[model samples]
Target chain A: MRIVVPAGGTGGARFVRGLLAALAEAGEPADVTVVGNTGDDITLWGLRVCPDLDTVTYTLAGAIDEAKGWGRPDETFTVRDELAGYGVLPTWFGLGDRDLATHLTRTSLLASGATLSEATATIAARWGLPGLGVTLLPMSDSPVETHVLVQHPDDPAGAPPRLVHFQEYWVGLRAAPRALDVVAVGAEQARPAPGVLEAVAAADVVLLPPSNPVVSIGTVLAVPGVRAALEASAAPVVGVAPLVGGAVVRGMADRLLPALGVEVDAGAVALHYGASLLDGWLVDTSDVHAVAPVEQAGIACRAVPLLMTDVPATARIAAEALRLAEAVRA
Target chain B: MRIVVPAGGTGGARFVRGLLAALAEAGEPADVTVVGNTGDDITLWGLRVCPDLDTVTYTLAGAIDEAKGWGRPDETFTVRDELAGYGVLPTWFGLGDRDLATHLTRTSLLASGATLSEATATIAARWGLPGLGVTLLPMSDSPVETHVLVQHPDDPAGAPPRLVHFQEYWVGLRAAPRALDVVAVGAEQARPAPGVLEAVAAADVVLLPPSNPVVSIGTVLAVPGVRAALEASAAPVVGVAPLVGGAVVRGMADRLLPALGVEVDAGAVALHYGASLLDGWLVDTSDVHAVAPVEQAGIACRAVPLLMTDVPATARIAAEALRLAEAVRA
Candidate 1:
């Protein structure tokens, strides 16, 4: 099976790990292509940082810090602390010493005229991604960063909103302030990275893992030609709900989803994606009532245990999504 | 007193610490400006690493690793070890975690359009150099790296010599290979950084600390207008010999000096600078015989105990250099 997954950071990484386990257990031979979101990419201390791509790569390589759900195991913060000592700003983002090596390598490659896609391939290869039957590509080679518009803290009343990089909102501000809107700054001008469109078009199945719909999957779809390719793909497109029991399993989806006026409900999220793009949707058993509402919108829907507490439990969820794809094909 | 000193790493930094201490003890209020060599600068992992400038800054700030003669007081190699694990080349250069912070700050500043001089001032301020009555400036704002020509290890018999960055030769190869020649790649066209020439011309006394003459002090002089300024200055130009007992006190000067066809003797080095640029020279008492030859070359020469074994001993040597400068002025 040729599978393509559009991923974000921690949550998407976990979901993909489960999907890999599901395929391996069933004795299925597969080629998985991951189209990672570049909307959260930020240049820190003159180094290009691709948070989502690194998370996916580290998780797959079994080098990730399982407790934090991101970064390398046994990471040190000596560099971060030293940077703070130098009075460099935005010290809130945790850049581990081990994780910094990836940024350094990628940044060095980019400095030498390599495109983002090329640099990502080089870094992913270091983590042995190809050996695991996975190919990871950025959503686009051109820069596209997510910026969040939030009410200015100092001028809360009758003041124009201020724009902050998504990382500042997510990591620095902890997403506390109300988000007025989110914008993918360069997405409109960005073409899909080489092989990204073809991956979606040629896949036996396209999966939308449990990632932030607004900044993760939505940002990937925002790249020109990407949404068109997915819409035109012959394969079934299935999505696993990022929410369980009307609450996000991880990340600040609840804080950001409402910025687009989407309710904090599994059914609302599925409906927001709508039937034209999604052939099937999977919600948690606790939100089984969402199944009926989603299916009524011309999309196949299923409810299963979606906690992802462990690999086994998450693999079961992935298997159910694949089964729903088969049903949609029928 | 207004003083100017041209410096490199380790040895020069140690000499400067003693100068500062000597000035303090004598109740002499002096504005000491250090022109640091930039020929040793290299871009590793896409970050600018200024070994000489950092060494002087860290030593003056009392944050230097005393045991190693450079870098921070307490440093970690997490970043270095991790970079090696990623199979990055040139891992021989030691980039401590705390030291990497300085490079990151500098690289970020330079990327944002700050010149090397401006960046040095900003970094020096953080280390409290200004508070201690010291001003640090790069020899040039423009990039001028020293490349050593050495016989290629693999093709020792016939292939034309290959050029390696000075760091690769000194740190990576331990300067074991015979150096054919040294070139300051961009020095001929480079202009002195702001205040460098002025510091030389306006100084009450000019001191050349015991830095590597070939790559450090010599490279600074190679900058188009710098040598002219030092020669034209009214202040006496005095140098402390890097050699003691006919050998380098530290570093690979012994390996590199012969490449210029100059003998390892203190008198030979003073004559290499010639009487036009240097008004006085200080050699170790063990090489007291060098004084007669150096003086015969129309330069004032002194034989002092030049071993900078500790702050007090180094301070006495610095005091002797200052006394020689005064005598030359008379």
Candidate 2:
């Protein structure tokens, strides 16, 4: 089976890791492609840092910091501490010692005219990733930084345009602001990362794990031809709901979904993705009541226990998604 | 008294620290001006690093690595180790975590067209150092990297040039190659750092600490009009030998002096500076026996124990050099 997984951050990566391992153990070797979102990538300390791409890479290599769910384990912040002494701001967002090499190499390559995909492949080879069982591609090769635009109550139409980079708003601010808009600032100029459109088009199943709808899937869809490829593909397009029991399983999804005028509920999310693009929507068992409401919106809906606690559970979820795709095509 | 010091590296910096402390203790309020060497600057991990200037700053700020006599006392190598993972070759120089910030800021500023001298002043202001009655100045505003030309008998100039950055040749190789040539690559195009000529022109006394004479002093002299200003000054010019007991006190100097066609001795070094440029020269008491040769070369020579073991000893050495310069001026 050729499965395309669109990944964004730690949650998406962890889920993908589980899926890959489970499929292998099930005696069914499948090719998995991760179209990672680089919307949150930022130029920091003169190095290009792609958070989601690195998260997936580290997780796949088994070098990930399990506790933080990102960066390398036992990573030192020797460089960050040194930067702090110079009175550099933004003390948060730990850029650990071991992780710096990744950024440095990526930044160096980008500075030297190589694209992000080329650098990613080189870094991947060093880690000896199991081919991903698959290809891991960025959403876009061109620069695209996600900006969270918050309208402070005191001054509307944007309070001097307080634009925070996605990570700054997502991690540093702990997602505290009343976000008026979450804008992928440079998406219009971004072309799909090489092989992204082809991977989606050629896939038997295109799956969206419980990644942030706005930043993750929304970003992937933002690329000039990515959404069009999904719509035009013969493959079954399925999405596992990020929202469960009217709340995000993790992260600031509850705070962000409202910006799109979408309620923090499974039915609302299914409608938001739209039945035209979504062949099947997987809602949590707790959100089973919303299955019919989603189907009434003209998309196929399934009620499944979506809480992925362990690898077996995730594999079961993956199996269920594949089963649903097969049934829809039949 | 307004004092101007032309210094190069760790040894030179330590001497200045000792001298400053001594001056403070002696109740002699003096305006200290330091003209630092920039020839050892090199690009690493895409950041332009100025080693000598930071050596002086960190030493003066009391954050210098005591044992290493370079980098920060509690320096971390987040960036270096990270860069290494990316297979960045020749990771010989230890750019500490704290040091990376300086380089990041300096490189960013330089990339933005601010001269080295302007950046140095900005860095100094942040260190809360002006109250110490000292001003640090880079000798040149232009980028000047020192390159060592090594000629292995097996390989010669026709074979695509055996060129290495000074740091790699010195620290990386430990200067193992036979001495061939030391060239300050950008010396011919360098302009004096802002206020460098003025400070030298308006000094009460000038001292050259025990830094690499070829790369350091040669680089300072490479700046246009700096040597002319020093010659025109009424203040006596004296140089303290880096050589003690016929050996360089530290680092790869012993191997490099010969490459510049100078013998590694106090007398030859004094003669290399020449009588017209230097009014006096300070040699180690071990080389007190060689003073006659230096004076015979028409430069007044003072023999003293020139090792900077402690703050007081360094101060005493500085005071003696100043006294000799005054006596010679009379």
Candidate 3:
């Protein structure tokens, strides 16, 4: 079976790892194509750093810093220190030395006229992802940066919002600022990267892991043809809530969700994606009471232990999502 | 007094450090502008690497690895290892993590339309070199890489030469292959960087450090107006021999000098520069017998203890070169 997953970064990456494990445990061979969100990509120090893509890639390749759920294992911040030494701005986004090679190769390849998808494939092959039955793809080839509008600190009346790169809000400020708005800068003009549509259309199941719906998967769907592809695909679409009991499992999804005026609840998230696009939704056992609201919205719902504590625990969650997908199909 | 010195990496950097010390010991504060050779500069993995300029910067800043005579002290090779992991070419050139930042900043600044001179000043200020009465300048603002023509390994007759980057010849091949010719690619069209001509023309004295005369000083003089500026200036030009007893102190100067068909003797190197460009030349004490030959070439010559065993010894050599400049001026 071909499984298509539109993912953000850390959370999505963990969920995909679970899905891979579940498939392996079943003794079934499967093809997994992860469409990584590129909205968080930024050009830093002349290097095109795709944070989401690298996070997913590093996690899948077993090179991820397990503690952080992102960046390379045993990563050193020497390069970051050096960049700061030169007074390069936005030093808040710590890029590890090992991780920098990926950006260097990607930037060099991109500068040489390779599209983001092409560069992704080149980097993926190096990680032996193909051998692991995994293909990592960028959501779009065109540049799409997630910029956040935060309430101006000086403006007590909040007349004008200060705009900053999504990274500055998320990583730099730790999402402390009250974000007034979130915008995927170029998503309106972005077309699905090569193979993105085909992967979705050909998949037996399309999964949205516990990624940020507002900025992560939301940015991917914002790309012109992506949402249409999911809607048109005959395959059932399943989503696992990033929020558990009104709080995010990882990252600052809580801060981002309310910016769009969406209630930070499992059922509210499923409804935000809406019944038409999502055939099924998975909520944590703690929010099992909220399953009825999601089911009432015409989407099949499942209550499972959604915390990806380990591969097996995550696999159970993945299995639950797949079971819900089967129920939706029935 | 204004002093200008044209330099390369390693030997040149050491010489410059000694010159700084010599000036300090004499309690004479002088405006010292170093015209760093850019011919050896290479773009690796899409980052503009000014090796000679960085060596001089790092050495003078007290951040250089004394043991290696280049790169930053306590540097990590994580980036280099990672690049090798990605199978990036020319992995032979070891770029330390701390050093990579310099290249990144320079590349970013250059990409943003800052002239190399402007970028150099920015980087120099970060190292506090400007505060220490020194200014680092690139020989030319334009890109000029040294490409070496070597005999193809398979061709015993040496009919067709294989052209590779000077770095590949020096670092990758370890100067094992006979370099048929060394070409400063793009030097002919290159113009001296901003302030280079002014520094040389306005100087009370100009010095050529004990760098590779064939490639280092040669490439700098190859710049369209640099040689003319030095020739037109009333200031005396003094050069210290890179070769000691027909062999170089370090690096592949011995291999490179012979590639140009010039004898690897102190006097021969002085004759190559000629009386028009060089007012004085300093050879090692061991090569005192060759002083008459250099003097006959219409350049004042002196023999001194040229080996830079330590900072003090190197400073003494610098002092000797200054004394020769004074004598030539008289």
Tens-digit per-residue lDDT, A221-328, candidate 3: 999989998999999999999988879878898898888999889889999999889999989889998899899989988888888889899999888888888888
lDDT of 1: 0.91
Tens-digit lDDT track of model 2 for B1-330? 888998888988998898888788779985889999989988887988888888899888887888888887776776676667667434787677777778877776777677788778878777756878889999887888888887543566566447788888877777888768887888888888888988988899888888888888777877778888888899989999998999988876788889888898888988888887888999999998779988888788988989988878988998888789888989
The digit string of per-residue lDDT tens for model 3 on B1-330 reads: 788999999899898889989999999995899999999898888888999999999999999999998899998898888888788445788888999889989988888889999999999999999988999999989999899999856567947787888887888788888888999899988989989998987899999999998889999998999999999999999999988898888987778877888888888899988899999999999899879999998999989999999999999999999999999999
Which one wins by DockQ: 1 or 2? 1
Model 3 clash pairs are none
- Identify the runs in model 1 with alpha carbons over 4 angstroms from their true place: A154-157
What value does the TM-score of chain B take for model 1?
0.98
Best by DockQ: 3
Docking class of predicted structure 1? medium
lDDT of each: 0.91, 0.82, 0.89
Ranking by DockQ: 3, 1, 2
lDDT of 1 by residue, A1-330 (tens): 899999999888888888989999999865899999999999888789999999999998899999999999999988888788778544688799989888888887888889999999988888888988899999999999999999857676998899999999998888999999999999989999999998998999989998999999999999999888888998999999999999988898999999999999998998999888999999999999999989999989898888989888888988988998888978
Candidate 1: residue A203 Cα off by (Å): 1.3
The ten-residue window of minimal lDDT in model 1 chain B covers: B82-91
Task: Locate the minimum summed-lDDT window of 10 residues in model 1 chain A.
Answer: A82-91
